[model samples]
Target: MLNAKWKKMLVGSTVGAMLVVGAAGAAFAADAASPAKSEKHAAKHQAKLEQKAAAQGLTVQQLLDRQAARKAALEEKAKAAGLTMEQYKAQRQAEHQAKLEQAAAAKGLTVEQLKAQHKERHDKVVEQAKAAGLTVQQWKDRKKAEHEAKLEAKAQKKGITVEQLKAQLAAKKAAK
Candidate 1:
């Protein structure tokens, strides 16, 4: 069995893989729609990328480069593990599913029941966002902005820049 640290690393990598796959799926779906819709989706995605890059004090190209680099690194890791990319992804996914099953059993619920509960919570959040006249993405963006504002205020109180505060927090986390 893997140790706790290795398990955590695997889980984090699995989540990263999921996000990359999800984004690609979304882009593919958008392209499958009408040309106008595809253009709109592309514009929206670009805007999001710009926003994220700005938040990280990076240009859009720099952000894209980083994402490409991360993907290449993951691919290299899969190669080193004697697995193709697809095989590595499948293995990681199976591990993640097993962990979910264990968690559900510990909670006295089956995996299906746990999934239903999660879906219900997600639906509720979507409904809440709708009631606020915002799309789910918009709602999430608002919440993120609010969180950053609070962090900025706290950093100001400590007489540090937000970047400095974030670096300090990251260093502390790494030390742990």
Candidate 2:
């Protein structure tokens, strides 16, 4: 009876330790996978923010400060332009509409009609993807692959990456 009880206790303790070790291994593997994913995500987000800052010719903090200051400056800019804020907004919208109208006319459609067509096409694509068991990200990945292929083909033709092509163009413009 004493030997049986000792054997039982040993078995129970071994099983418990194995369970804890198994759980720890699984948790470690999960943690390992996520840091790589999160690091990639963080890198992409940082690149995007940097691009936005560069486009504005400002540092990231300055870009944020500029956006914060824009609210107070909007009225001043509009006033300087000899229009009230509402008038300025309407004028800007009219200019945008005119550009859109010109673009739509080139494609043989009115702007409103063209937008409806675009909405219908977008909806159809979404519905078809759902029917085909594709998530939005899957569709986006396919589109990205297609775009990258085109870019690669173009780069091959030009014998350069897109960045190299842009640099060549800039050099040409500067020479001119």
lDDT of 1: 0.91
Report lDDT (Cα) of residue 142, candidate 2: 76
Compared with the true structure, the alpha-carbon lDDT of candidate 2 equals 0.83
State each model's CA lDDT, in order: 0.91, 0.83
Q: Write the per-residue lDDT of candidate 2 for residues 1-176, one digit (tens) a residue.
A: 56988999999999999999999999999999999999999999889888778644568888778777896698888999999989988998999999989989988998998889879987887776677667544666777899878877888898898778767868999998
> Quick one: best TM-score, which candidate?
1
Error of 2 at 149 (Å): 7.5
Candidate 1 structure quality by residue, lDDT tens digits, 1-176:
99999999999999999999999999998778879887889999999999888655578999999999989998998999999999998998999999999999989999999999999988997888879877676778888999999999999999999999999999999998
Relative to the true structure, candidate 1 has a C-alpha RMSD (angstroms) of 23.6
Worst 10 residues of 2 by lDDT: 132-141
The backbone clash count of each candidate, in order, is 0, 0
